[model samples]
Target: MAMSKFWWKSDSSKDKSIHWMCWSRLTAAKCKGGMGFKNLRDFNTALLGNQAWRLISFPDKLLNWDPTLSYIWRSVMEAQALLVQGISCCIGNGQTVDITNSPWLPSIEDPFVHSDNKAISNQKVISLFKIDEKAWDIELVLDVFEERDAELILSIPLTENDKDTWYWRHEKMGHYSVKSGYNVIQASKNQPNTVDNSRFWRKLWNLKIPNKARRIQVNAQCPVCNLCDESAIHSLVTFSFAVECHQFSSVKQVAGDYHIFTEWLQMVFEQSNNRDICIQEDGLEQWCPTSSNSVKVNVDAALFTDPNRYNYAIVVRDHLGHLVQAMSKCSLGKVVSRAIRECRHQRSP
Candidate 1:
């Protein structure tokens, strides 16, 4: 029967004929009522791939990879040697060598080679060598040198109050290096480039704090009460006014039908707590009067004694309008017929 249904002709199957319609509502961007389809799982994977590539490439500034010293070591060693010679001459010349004067040296404890009457002393030379080693360590070099996306780096010239300030901005643009120094580089698809300086200037000029402040102030007011002090929890749970809203009343009315069985059970338990209720050995549904100034609740055994009969459970309420007790007959089966009646009773009337 199930196999036959697979090939069964139906009006619903006509729409499912096209695979694109299964995922989306339209076909093309310009088409009226055309649904755009997107595979969320594939989109998520692609986004994650871009992030992973970014992490591996830009390990220097983003990951704090200090390659400044290493790059200098490979390309500008001669310049560094000249700087060292200048430092040595400055210290050797009779000018008082205050360790604080040298920018190359990181600390005051750095040792210097003092020339004793033109010839360099061996002890002072060794101290100078030690200081040089320590200075090299302070240059900030990374252990590993991995090439990163160059185009991702760019310098943005920002002006606040007619002051020129350049800021570095890095972002992934596939395989391209987005550095600010390159004039040939094109701006992002949505972003305006240097060629459109007029639009860019307008955007920068319109960037006022009051606009953002206005937006924040608009959303700052509570949706429920229009009060600034009203919060999410206050609107949903604690607010007495919120509970009186029409929406809450409508929701409660809809929920009442779904919780009928559970609500009835609760009422029964509450009633039994304050009143006397009796359960017959044979399952039956009945009511009896009590004498302890409590609501009376009783059950007859005939309801369950019949082997092929189905009976409904009864709920009893107290004078205070609270549910006081409930009783139900056992199932019409042999297991319950011989088993002791297990009637859970409570009183909270």
Candidate 2:
């Protein structure tokens, strides 16, 4: 720690005012409102934790005469103790998991330990899995747990392996590394700063569309305002006349001066929107010929310069390139009938 402070002072050339932010704040991650400086203390702890985990998980390796007798090994034990705070076990055949104590369940709360059956105290989770249907033995689970807890246990996927796998919750794919360890430490201390402009922006987004989220659904266009495509993020946050409404509300100065969308939501929302923008119908490669016995329907529409009008067409093709059905339509009035015409003129399906 002293060596790091010495290096910091040398790097800064003894300029006190130019340091601007404190050492701790600068050491945080950018996403968590830090300057991206590496937190050496956390970094050291993370590295030590990895070694400690290895020693604890594997004891028979090198230096056979009691590894804990050494100072380095003892220091590593301290780091390992801290690392276990963020560790959880993924239930497999569940041989290694202690069902009552291990942090295997996905819920925020620990597994309920007040089971009426004392026999299950040390039993492996795999004992509860039914191989026939590749699912948990629901009756046995319900015997030990309430309905809600039983549902959560059943949701976790069980593997055919003979042992459970340990995972660092902060890391990806259940694999631990020094970088992830450092991140875990930093996140433990991270506190949201509401003074920043980003905080106010987060509240503006309308995220109450639970129905669409549950059914894996999204609307083609904004439900309240038909001009822009409706999304769970940006479009939902705004009405069609947001500018007018905000301007009229006497808060235009505060709203217009800031950039669009909230700070935290903007970064995440844009990334999700970009992934779905790929064109699935690229060309003729996607067009496969109909099967010998079954017919295929092909429908397409062309948009017109008028917002209310469209030159729409639909056709069905047979296995032998025969036209089984055909239809065409165009709007004759100012009404936005392109969508309505497409649905109603579908051969009354």
Candidate 3:
């Protein structure tokens, strides 16, 4: 209620204002037309669940706790139920997973085997694997289960030497994240996503405007132009300096008269040429070799415009500067800076 009130109420006003949308809708994802505001309760639960995930994933680090323990530890332990709902066992050796009860399939929805066979209900996932071949026993799988169940079981890849481990089903990399946990909680409510303005949002975010120009300023009146209000559109498009920049830039004739900022941005994007700009600073340090007995890894990535692909290469070298391994791959996707952010977040304590 406090969050909702703060969102709807103005800084200058103490009087209550009408909330334009329900709290649930307001907290929905931006693609769904809401502002992507986090529901504090759900967010708090998700955070606690992340701590619980750490406890489960690293049981060795766990300490004995009771009602007398710290409030934070007790709260995290209580959120184990929330974490359990969104986690599934990734099939490794599959020795510990129950065939009927365990969630071991390569799926998020209905991960458990949907089988009526009373005979295999109590069996473990290892029973489905060929003992000698380190692979799924195809004949036994086909004969013992229904078609869908059989197919799902066959689709699961196994690492014969590795032990079964629980993973977050909401993420592709099988890693638990607070955002994914929150999404799982949201999914349980069966909230309908009415709008999908993802394309518009993506384009708006991908605009090549500078950070200083993108941010909203307190004063609306243009300090330089004096004739119009200063906004993203005005500063980036209509201001005299911006006009001069466009004239000087490779994109020689960008118009500032478009009715909407998106249209103007779209025009700028469409008309813009793929011109590479490089700035080199003096006194930049060069790569140095690692310490003795250690190996160093370096990775570089490039974004290609014509085919919309990201190509990356990784190289590993020993302390002696001898090449250990080198590999490169190309993938079709948006820029991978988001992955970098995820990696940083996951590594945070």
Best by TM-score: 3
RMSD of each: 26.8, 20.2, 21.7
Residue range 1-349, candidate 1, lDDT tens digits:
2222333435688544434343323221212232323334333333433333344345353432355645423332322322222122112221233322232221222323121232222222122222423221111111111112111111111122222111112222223122221211111112444233455545554566554343333465554334435555445433444445523332231222222445543544554543344455687534444444566443345444457555656666664546787877655643343112211111112
Off by over 4 Å in 3: 65-74, 192-349
Please report how far candidate 1 places residue 222 from its true position, in Å: 3.8
lDDT (CA) per prediction: 0.33, 0.63, 0.78
Model 3, residue 63: displacement in angstroms? 3.4
Query: Model 2, range 1-349, lDDT digits (tens) per residue?
Result: 4534554566547554234567886675555455577876678888898886675456656743445577776667657655766777777667677777777777533444445467677787767877755568988898877676678788887666666666666655766678877776776676666355444334433345454354656568754445556554334235434444444442322323323566434543444455543335553335567889888887777666656576768878888878889998886445444444443454264
Clashes of 1: 16
What would the TM-score be for candidate 3 when compared with the true structure?
A: 0.52
Candidate 3 or 2, higher lDDT = 3
In model 3, residue pairs whose N, Cα or C atoms come closer than 3 Å (at least 3 residues apart or on different chains), thus clashing, are none
Better of 1 and 3 by lDDT: 3
Considering TM-score, where higher is better, how would the candidates rank from best to worst? 3, 2, 1
Write the number of the candidate with greater TM-score, choosing between 1 and 3. 3
